[model samples]
Target: MIERDPLAPSRWSAEYRTGEFDEPFPWKPVLGVLGIVLVIVFAHLELQSKRIDELHTAINARLGGELEPLRGRFTARLSTLRAWLELREIDGPKMRAADLDFETIRSGGLLSVRRKRSAPGGGSSIELDSDEFGECLGVPSTSIARIQRRLAEFTPELRDEIDRTDHFLTLRGMQDQLDRRIDALLPELSLAIEARFLLLSEEDAEARELMLLLVDLESGQEKLRMRVPYEGRLLTARVMLDETTRAKSPGSIALPTELPKGASDCAAASTLREAIDGRHSIGEPMPEGGEHAAE
Candidate 1:
């Protein structure tokens, strides 16, 4: 047999060589691995960018839409409160009696009571005929209570608005100031995960404290608004008395009698000014009127 040539060309020679493999395209494995990693990283960054945009959009919706409307409602209720306080001269007993007289004639109570003036003042004139004055006094008080109830609805709405704003701004500031960069450029997935956890932990604590304070504010404002009508009706009634007498008799006691000691002492006075000073810890006497009344 002819001696086999060791390096001789054969059909199976290229396939059989095994010592040190080399390819015509030697860099393909390294390039393929790098391309796969690049694709994955770019896709992850795209998704994160989309999520950050979504967060910003969510923030705008809550701050502008919900918060603004609730604030407007609070403003409107405040205006109503001022109007209620200013309406100090609401009609008293005589005016209400006149209104009732017109209604009674229309409804035919006139047919029942004969108008008996005691033959040219033989005794002290019956001041109000008693029963009619009681009915008349309820008018201004009822009107004031109606205004109070409208204000009552604001307490909860305002609280909710404040809590919502607190939550949104806290989250928004965190995302804007801290998270945007780290989430985008970091190579390792674990680092981004750790950062997100830390940020959320801090935000949660702040939100809880803010919510509690908002609740307390809501309760306090509600109490103040409620007392206004209770005290306001009394003051309005007194002012009405002064106006009625002024209309008929000309000179009389001023609408506010000189406050004895000006409610300056802590002693009990039934009037609105005294009540406000006691409640608000204001020792200085409010001048002659309702809460906003000029001194």
Candidate 2:
């Protein structure tokens, strides 16, 4: 109510008391700042998403470019190897069975008999025959004598035993003893043969399983190769891929690149010589260009 001095500080005016100095909370400036912040955040997120997409594309391209060719080469070589293994499997069983049969006979399945023979000079020599050695001794005496000579070379101990025995009855007893000895040896012989058969069977099975796995891998690679864009350098890449797949062996396929770790387990590096010649000396190598030989 008192008059105010001009130089003195003035008391609050009616406008100030009514909030006229507040400036409506500056909502436009605040909204503008918020918009700028949102734009910056969205821009950063967009950049991150774009980078992620680029990385994904790069990874996929690398996989298609590199892994697919390797897979193709591996498959081709594996197919060749599997073919060879199949051939071995086909011819192996009959030969092994025949050998086992011979082993059974050699282990003592034949009888041994000796008879006195009169030579052309009127001096007598010893002759031999048995159920296993010669045919029934009477019908064709010449055939019997030839068989006896062959048996002499094969079973000298049996011949000696027969010759030492005085009487035919004693020789018969010795034959029975040989039969019993054979029966006693059969179980062990059969066990050995079975063990060998199982070993070979297991080896063949492992090779087959590895071949199947390679087939699956090859199928997957083929699909991936199809997906790869055929444009640009990829066309040349495909040509090179074809060349790689045409390789006959792992050494040729992995050339200029180290073999994958599991390659040895697949037997991919095994030589053609090893497959053809084999480790065993059981039979002669199949002649080259033979119909049965794998190409």
Q: Per-candidate TM vs. native?
A: 0.26, 0.28
Per-residue CA lDDT of model 1 for 168-264, tens digit only, reads 4455565464344322222222221121110000001222210000001111111111111111111112222356555534343345433332131
**Collision count for each candidate, in order:** 0, 0
Q: Best candidate, TM-score-wise?
A: 2
Q: Candidate 1, 295: how far from true, in Å?
A: 15
lDDT of 2 by residue, 1-295 (tens): 2333556775665553444333457779999999999999999888766655554444334334543344345345435434322322221211111112223222322221222233432232423222211122111111222332432332556545554554444544655665454444333333222221111011122222211110011111100000101111111112233466775433333223443323322232132112222432334432322222233
lDDT of 1: 0.29
RMSD of 2: 35.3
Q: Name the 10 consecutive residues with the lowest summed lDDT in model 2.
A: 221-230
Model 2 CA deviation exceeding 4 Å by range: 1-18, 21-24, 88-201, 204-292
Which 10 consecutive positions of candidate 1 have the poorest summed lDDT?
A: 195-204
